[model samples]
Every structure is written in C-alpha cells, then in structure tokens.
Target: MYTTLLHQYQLTLSSRNALFDYCETVKPEDLLKPLATINNESMASLLLHVANCYVFWLANSVMQEKHAYFKGDEHLDLTAVRNVYGQVDLLMNEFLNHFKDSLDVPLLITRPDGSQLTRSPFEIFTHAITHEFHHKGQVVNMSRQLGYTPVDTDVVRE
Candidate 1:
C-alpha cells in the first residue's frame, strides 16, 4: 500500500505539472489578473493555494516541520512556481518516507478554527491530493475563460 500510494503521489505530481506548463503560456502581466468568474482568484493564487495545502498537510501536520509560502505569490512567475514546487516535493517525499510505517496512526491536526481533527497520514495525503485536483479544475476553467486552453491533466490514461 505504501508503494502504491507513493506511485499515486508521483503521478499526481505529473498531473499537476501539466497545469503548471499551461501556466507558462499565460502573459506575464496576466498571471495575476483576477478572474471575476472563479472566486476572483488569480491564476498564481490558485497555484499557490495548492502548493500551500501540500505543505500544511505533509510538513506541518505529519512531519511537524515548517513551511513558507507568501501571500504576495500573485507576483510569482512560472519559474518561481516551479521553484516552490521543488521545495514542496522535497518535503512531501520526506513526509512519505518518515510516515510509511505509521500510515494508520492517528494524527491530531489543529484547524484554523481551533478545532482538532484526528486522521491518519494516509487520509491526510489523500485529502491533500484531492484538494489540489479540485482546484486544478478551477485553474483550468479560469485559464479557458482567459483564452488559454490547458492540456488535459486527468490521470485516467496519462
């Protein structure tokens, strides 16, 4: 199960990279243009949100490590986004390796509202991936609305 889960994580990375590549096709100034349709979030903000989720779950919750993502990420370009992804990937790999033996062990994660929820590392990882996938759809929609059609990121046949 650990190995399979690890494969899934890697595949998710590939799926996400497809979107990041699409981001590169956007005009530099337009990256931060707020899409009035989709929650008013810019393209960069959505990507940053996805990256931050990985850090929050893998680094903060499970590994008890620190993460650094800035609120001014709308200024970040595709290259900077790639750099952030590199850091996040490193942290996630560490988290997976460290918690391989404790997939079912309940971990107490404190929410923003001060509530604590107990979940296993496996569950947390699954949640993080799904969260990103959900937002990826939004990113796609925003890009299309902006006239940039992104490549298919679905993992079904990729």
Candidate 2:
C-alpha cells in the first residue's frame, strides 16, 4: 500500500516538474502579475500557496513540525520557488516514512483555532496532493491568460 502511494506521489512530482519547467519560460514580470480571475494571485503566488498547503497540512499539522510558511512575494523567482519545494520534498519524505506503517491509523490534530480533528495519514496525504493538482489547473489557466499555451502535465500520457 505504501509502495502504491509512493508511486502515485512520484507521478505527481513529474507533473509538477513539467509545470515548473513551463514556468521558467514565462516572463519574469508576468509570472508575478496578478490575474483577476485567479483571485488576483500571481503564478508565483499560486506556486507558493501550493507548497504552503503541504507544509501546513503534512509537515506542520500532521507531523507536528513547526515549519515557517513560504511567502509568495518573497519568492519572486523560480529558483527561490524551487528552493522552497526542496524543503517541501524533505518534509514529504519524512511524512511518508513516519506514517508508512500507520497510513490508516487515526491521528488527532489540533487546529489553530483550538478545535480538534482526527485524520488518518492516508487522508491527509490524499488531501494535500489533490489540493495541489486542483491549484495546478488554476496555474495553467493563469498561464493561458498570460498568452502562453499550456503544456501536457498529466500523470498519464496519450
């Protein structure tokens, strides 16, 4: 079961890299340009937001690690964005290994608002990755609005 999840996550990374490669081709200025349709969030901002979600859910919330959130404006370039993801990768590895044998075991987590929720490792992992793919689509649309054609970043290819 863990192997299956690992394989799926690997595919997710491949698709993410495809998007990152495309982001490199976008104009530096346009990468930071806020799109009205995307809640006035820039491509760079959206990318950081995706990473932040992982850190928030997986690293901070689930793993009980206190990782500082990545700020979008601070990571204006793809290189800086990549650096943030590098940290994300480390967190992901830790998350997977720590919960490999207990993917379905419910863990109680405290919310920032003093509330509590019980979630399994599998559910948290699923939520984080699916949230990522959802935002990936938004980022692609944002790129399209910036006059660049989208690339093929799906896990399955024709």
Candidate 3:
C-alpha cells in the first residue's frame, strides 16, 4: 500500500508540474491579478492555498510539526512557486516515510475552531490530494477566464 500510494503521489507531481509549466508562461503580474469571479483570489493565491492545505494537514495536523504556511505575496513567481512545492515534496516524503508502517492508524487532530476529529494517515493523504485536484480545476478555469488556454493537468493525460 505504501508503494502504491508513493507511485500515485509521483503521478500527482507530474500533473502538478504541467500546471507549473503553464504558469511559467504567464506574466508575474497576471499570476497576481485578482479575479472577482474566483472570490478575488489570484492564481498565485490559489496555488499557495493548495500548498498550505498540504502543510496544514500533513505537517501540522498529522505529523505534529509546526511548519509555517507559504504566503501568496512571497511566492508570486514561478521560481518561488516551484520552491514552495519543493517544500511540499519534502513534507510528503517525510509523511509517507513516517507512516509507512501505520498508515491506517487513527490519530486525533484538532481543528482551528477548537474542535477535534480522529483520522488515519491514509484518510488525510486522500483528503489532501483530492482537495488539491479540486482547486487545480479551479486554477485551470481561472486561467481560461484570464484569457490563457488551459493545458492537460491530469494524472493520466492523453
């Protein structure tokens, strides 16, 4: 199961890189341009949000680490975006390795609102990746709305 999950994550990274490649062609100002249609979030913000979610859930909540969240203003360029994801890749590796023997063990997590829930590492991993994809779709739509053509950003692109 660990090997399977690792393979899937690598595939996810490939798709994510495709998105990054598209982003590299966009001007920095455009990446930071706010779209009222998408709740005033710029493409950079959305990307940062996706990275933050992974850090929050996997690093903070699951691993009990206190890594700081990536900020949008600080990571507006493609280089910064790639650096942010480099951190995410490291975090993902640490997570998968730490839980290799206990992916299904339920662990208690506290919400920001002070509430709590028990979730297994497998469940958290699933939630994080799916949430990323959901916003990845939003990123594509936002790009289209911004007058840029969207590219294939799927795990299994044709």
Best by TM-score: 3
Residues 1-158, model 2: lDDT tens digits: 78988998999999999989888899999989999999999989988999999999998899898999998768989999989988888898889999999999999998888899999999999999999999999989999999999888788854
| Higher-scoring candidate on lDDT, 2 or 3 | 3
**Model-by-model lDDT, in order?**
0.82, 0.91, 0.92
The 10-residue segment of model 1 with minimum total lDDT is: 66-75
Off by over 4 Å in 1: 73-75
Provide the lowest-lDDT 10-residue window in model 2.
Answer: 149-158
The digit string of per-residue lDDT tens for model 1 on 1-158 reads 78988899889988888878778788876778888897788878888888888888888766777676645544368788778888878887888888889898998888667788899999988998999899989988887888886788887645
Error of 3 at 158 (Å): 2.6
Model 3, which residues run further than 4 Å from truth? none
Model 3 TM-score, all chains together: 0.97
Off by over 4 Å in 2: none
Clash count, predicted structure 2: 0
